[model samples]
Target: MIYQKTELGQRAMKDRHAVEITRAQRSALILLDGQRSTASVLDATLSLGVSREDIDRLAELGLIATMPGSASADMPRGDAQLTDFASSTLAARHGPMDLPVAPNNEEERVRRYKKAYPLATQITATLGLRGFKLNLAVESAQGFDGLIELLPKIRAAVGDERVQPLRDALEGR
Candidate 1:
């Protein structure tokens, strides 16, 4: 998702050397760089866990630039340096952003876990049950484990039960 620069973003850009951005923001920038509308950017960024406010702020800070109508330079460019810069800034300001959390309610959790289950299952399967089970147990034994350990750490983390069924399953419940 690409977010265009608003006047605020332009103004912010004029003064700042670099503005912090979340991983989603960076991905949005890569996807919706040149000629993408603010709305598109917002949609894309939101999907990646970035808030519209953050995108707007990044624009205001001049870290992201928005152009109109398919301009090549305006297109989302995948530059490792820019991504690194944005990631670093976000880390400094808010810390690292990573996996989605287990939802609070069963329905939401199920929905979220369903979305993530395949991937988690795939990884665990690749690692083999014994290894995966052992790893998960060790991590959760301390109150959190594996991806669950990181989910609550990200900003705007959601709690879902469906996604956690695997965690429960691993615990032999």
Candidate 2:
């Protein structure tokens, strides 16, 4: 069976391993881009001293997974739909948009709320009922999972290209 890197894996690579991963693990990780087979990855990483254990470690970290043939598959979906929805919604209304920066500590949260409120209020006013709900949702969002769950709704309110910056801010990156 072949394994592909998850979004978290891509984030790890892009962020230069925010998690505690070994050199061998990183070596093996750079090879599982959804196109390579397990055997091919093993061969490619031979000089880097990568092993099956490294691959297993990535899987354990939820950084990689097999494609959708197995019973216990965890395939990610809805990105395209979200993008489409965001595109259409923004195009219909056609106005200036200000993205909210997520807050970390309590002090930052206060600052963030101050900044986000005016923008949210202005935008939401234009959107009517949906806008009001989105403003409340943005203010009430909790952690990473909460932010991710709210991403689709946010994109629908804003646009497709703005969520990553907001997520990065939320992650304190």
Candidate 3:
């Protein structure tokens, strides 16, 4: 069956806030450009160890869809609705929106840095190897503002769902 990115998936692709997905899933997602057959995409992703399940998960996440009438007999079209993408890739969890001015006081800055830093690391850490660079970025962040600047990148990497924790910490939650 041929699969293509859904509107939700398209938005995820266009936006910088890419949801955090397994490397396999991300690879599959990139290959599922509508014209490609499921088997072809799968074949291409074999190097990445992507399987039908990973593709299915992308479908489940609503990042990709089987073209209308493209359903093959082997894979039953069940009642299951596609899931939104990971890490809004299908749903990027933007930690709070449009960041405001950073706390001016050193104490408050330090406090926020302490609070948000771990959350940021935790988020990037979920990506495993793909996240190593971003994890380092989180580590190099100097203070609250530096960490805050990284929020958008974080949101792009993991999507908004995972960003909630970082967002909460930034908001002093």
For lDDT, the strongest prediction is 3
Residue-level lDDT tens digits of model 2 in 1-173: 47888999988898884778988788778888777776557545543445566887899999899876643222112222322333333334443234444445677665544544444434435655535556666556553445545554565555555544553454444
Which ranges of candidate 1 are over 4 A from the true structure? 1-19, 65-173
| Full candidate order by lDDT, most accurate first | 3, 2, 1
Candidate 1 vs candidate 2, lDDT winner: 2
Q: Count steric clashes of candidate 3.
A: 18
lDDT of 1 by residue, 10-123 (tens): 543454434555555555555544466654454334324454555655666565664544343322234324332333334444455454444556666555444444544444
Which stretch of 10 consecutive residues in model 3 shows the poorest summed lDDT?
Answer: 84-93
State which candidate, 2 or 3, has the greater TM-score. Answer: 3
TM-score, per-candidate, Cα-based: 0.30, 0.39, 0.45
TM-score of 3: 0.45
Candidate 1 Cα deviation (angstroms), residue 135: 19
The TM-score measured for candidate 2 stands at 0.39
- The number of the candidate with the highest TM-score is 3
Ten-residue region with minimum lDDT total, candidate 1: 150-159
